[model samples]
Target: MSQSNALIIPGLKVALVPCPALGDTTLLLRLAWRLQAAGACVTVASVSLASVRSYLPGLNIVGGAPDVVALAASNDLVICAIDWQVTVPLSNVAYLAGKKLPRGFNPEQPPVLLAGRVIAGAHNVICRDPKAGKTMVQWIDLYAEEVLGLDTSLPVTGLQDLPAVAEDADRRVAIFPTTPHASKNFSSSGFRRLARCLTARGWLVEFVGIPAEQQKLKAEYPGCTVRTFTDLKGLVDFLSNCAVVISNDSGGGHLGSLLGLRTFTITRRRGDFTWRPGFNELNRVINPILSFKWMGRTVWRPFIPLRRIVRALADVKVQ
Candidate 1:
């Protein structure tokens, strides 16, 4: 097909099936922007309502493979953000019948199998090393300009349109203190201590989480302010106006960094660190100083001290 002809296909549609987690969806959102810039209409397809809302505003939620196939039939390009193993059968069947199925995020080299049929491969923007993370972000920015044919003049304020706390009060601090898993959760006692320390430092701490988590944090933290956020807008608003954010290795930490907030993240050694957010120089990561294997197991042998986290927080600069 001619380049202009491909660009003018009236029914050309691109579908992005984001991973189950909110962070993955957020990454996919960046890709969606690039795809849209490439002249393909993009729609995010997912199963989680909250996940869909967090990353994709007008998502097409699907219940099963049949629904996905139906959606794929009408589209010219489909990017599977979910694990390739789960979607390989559907992708193969679709491709055999002349549909485009582009694979996403393999650690190895890009496959030559669907050459020309695939719009882009997933390995282009993923990184595990901290230094490479910055490179990956830069590559994505370039991809948006070069491959996607987008202008380089667009503003790159990450998540700036989302709702946030109303004011930048000097005394307010946003404490994003929850994780999706128990292993990543800091000790409640440690959190209470941290809250009291921030309060003593004249910072009014607000705990942000889902509704149920807000209730739990309130019961645990007593005097701390608790806010239950329903959408990405609300979360962004809260993070944007906060003085600083102390969170686990969850979506909150990523959101905090994206909003230019000073962020401190507490993560277990075993948690995935490949996609950690880069907040210029204001973000800190605290993990147990133990062997890699020790951190990977669910239970730990207490290789690191809580004092290290306290010291790290103490060293943070408000600016």
Candidate 2:
């Protein structure tokens, strides 16, 4: 392990640089909490820090990329969760923050990690770039167990639901169809059919997302309720009361998982087999397409079979 990876005590500051994804933020937040419990002050550096800043307290939140050396020099340690952030041009974080980066920090070698429990463990050597085939959370879990000496079995990363109110007293099934990327979403038609089917089965279905999306979904099924939230708090409260949540492989799904709701996430990423299969069984990630190269694209068209999704979801007895 490189010297920079060593955890110094009395002033250990861990900067968890995460990808802009909600899953990345959600899982890394657990690591941040664990580090905090272990007495190290942790900060989460992300472009979307504002969205998550409320969930994290006592820890610093940095926006955009800062000089790793300057970041590390100020704190006792810095943990890079996003793999590319550690490479050159991102400020050569491989070099222990004070001096030049050593060879063990090289990309080809196993992660040069800090041993002992002085601070949290980061996958500096064995970092998973692209984070394609595995649950990103599991990778962080490994770091927590091997480097931080913390118990990985406990669930530490869950986001809380706001205080109960009369509006949220009647919980219903939520369907979040809109995603930032079109490729990650199911056809509106699929959701329409699923919503009708669920409501037919006596489930109170509610659709949440942008105003336009809510309008569109409502048009498809007049029986189901369609709602939109203006802020994160509204979204959290609505999701917190949901008996079951079916969402795209986007922030909504991550939020549902963070709320510990029974969620079924539709995804196209093939790496799920490595992490989500047996361990993360509650957060069911349904992806029909494993891998395909078509027309110069690594992952070809993603078409989630809605009937199978309904069947899988039917197995879950929602509370």
Candidate 3:
């Protein structure tokens, strides 16, 4: 028989089921750390645990419905970071109870949110940092305060101290040139030009992509260096060491925000500006529309001029 909570004694057992996005997993890592500090044994239920396991280490990683349900039933606290675009067991409270629980959630704080809402609303449903204001990256502290009941003042240093990064203003430039969706990959030619543009100016440029894309990038641009990463930690370590990051509003971009890199996300969606108001001063985002008046007419153009991005980052210290 599996060990029961009785054997584990008073240590709190918590399960966090996050949206199956790398960005969400990175954010959930923040939440997981808080729970662990509060004496909770945290389990992450996910299909996307390979990268997470590599970064976090020793986490109780699990997937599939039966395993997730059993883990949730056994745990003292169960939380699911709901991404409405996807389906998971925590979609509704009934999915947890296998039947509906009492539906008397306070209307003011509607249960539609991930931490507090109408469906799979667990002990708490944390909505995307409320309209009341908080940077997207900064809200993790708020969640720690309000949800995990941890002291709000303590700094969130990592398990082991990260090695000191280079202090040079002319350090490497990290670029993630691909997005999961093709349409969102700002411009391939533009990214290459930017990398070459920066590389020629005495800055080492690092490009990241899938194996195939990396191969293509190397074949196309034989002179530049392109590194492919399979784990999130490697990605983080690389980005952490870089002066700045440029990406197409993908998970890597979000991770950059978490690490407080001067990340500039070039996007196709106009709504992303207001929707993903990032967590800090370093996490600035922009699109061509903000720079070019003709952008609204050619918004659907495959290529956005690199000059627009250059102008936007004019004030950024691109060492």
Candidate 4:
């Protein structure tokens, strides 16, 4: 498992296929940045382009496996972070799956990433699921260091690496109180109250979500500014101008962390360590409950006091 001699060639073409989830896509950016920094051409292929493309400004991204086939045909390597039903006809494929928690898994340990059977007859099937506590970004870093033999000790990217956006003169806090799953979301009332508290503190508060949920959120938080975007770029541009991001266990937190913005991610499960926004040192994960189960709805989401959230926001330094 030692990668002492493994080295990436300059101008090497690589295609990375990550899980379609926005958080997963954001996590994979670290690996992509490493590859690109080493003079390797990196492209991310996923179905959730609208959710991820905004954050991936410089990296090339294709829609899915269909688009990847032509691109991978010319690329030197193709790495997949998820199990693919359709295989790319490439000789040098790597399967990097099983990074998420399994059913009835030990809540105290990191999720296991198994190098299952090769899907596209891969030459290099590399995965390392050390039981040690690690975040999703760290898991990818392990894969790069141990599997690909790449040096990942130093920080790969900073705010200077991203395209510059003029910061707002006023301190703006983008609040994303929604997640794909209802169980992961804190109560709407809790979010509304949090927004009002920020407004009272002379901070500009805004609620962000997809266009489909725009009307609903506006109705829920009538006084607050509810902004929606149809594409990831719009959201990314909006987030770039903000000072801090407060969100549920969702992509908003992940995106904010990737942008090197101070993010306070509210979670229901302490076991979601792998899913936390770990790219930034200033990022904080606040949990209302300890258990990572159905009790999150009853015991956790319903009881997240506004004071706790305000306290968490004030605790972090803005630098």
Q: Which lDDT tens digits does candidate 1 get at residues 243-293?
A: 677777677765666667666777664333544555346676666666345
Quality of model 4 by C-alpha lDDT? 0.67
lDDT of 4 by residue, 1-319 (tens): 1333344555778878877677877766678888776667788776665355655566777774535456557777777664552343343555455444334423223221222222222222222343454667777776676656576764564323344666552378999988889868878888887888877776788999888899899999997899998776677778888878889888898888887678888876563466677777867777764443454434676545458657866654433
In terms of lDDT, the poorest run of 10 residues in model 2 is: 91-100
Clash count of each predicted structure: 7, 5, 13, 0
Winning model by TM-score: 4
For every model shown, what is its TM-score relative to the native structure? 0.66, 0.68, 0.67, 0.79
Point to the candidate with the largest lDDT: 4
- The regions of model 3 sitting more than 4 angstroms off are 1-10, 46-66, 82-135, 138-153, 159-170, 219-222, 270-280, 290-319
Q: What is the lDDT of residue 1 in candidate 4?
A: 19
On the 0 to 100 scale, the lDDT of residue 284 in model 1 is: 68
User: Is candidate 2 or 3 superior in TM-score?
Assistant: 2
Off by over 4 Å in 1: 1-12, 46-66, 83-165, 169-171, 270-272, 279-281, 289-319
Question: Sort by TM-score, best first: what order?
Answer: 4, 2, 3, 1
Q: Which stretches of candidate 2 lie over 4 Å from their true place?
A: 1-11, 46-58, 62-70, 81-134, 147-157, 165-171, 210-224, 268-280, 287-319
lDDT of 2: 0.59
How close is each model in CA RMSD to the real structure? 6.7, 6.5, 7.7, 6.1
Least lDDT summed over 10 consecutive residues: which range in candidate 4?
110-119
Which candidate would rank higher by TM-score, 1 or 4? 4
* Tens-digit lDDT string for candidate 2 (1-319): 3334434333566666665555556666667777766557777776655554665566677877655656655654566544434343332132211112344555424343333332322334333443446555565566666765555555453453354644433347788887778877777777888888876665678888876576666776677678887655677767767767788776776667666667777667653533332223467766765567779865633456557656766675644
lDDT of candidates 1 onward, in order: 0.55, 0.59, 0.58, 0.67
Q: Compare candidates 2 and 4 on lDDT and give the better one.
A: 4
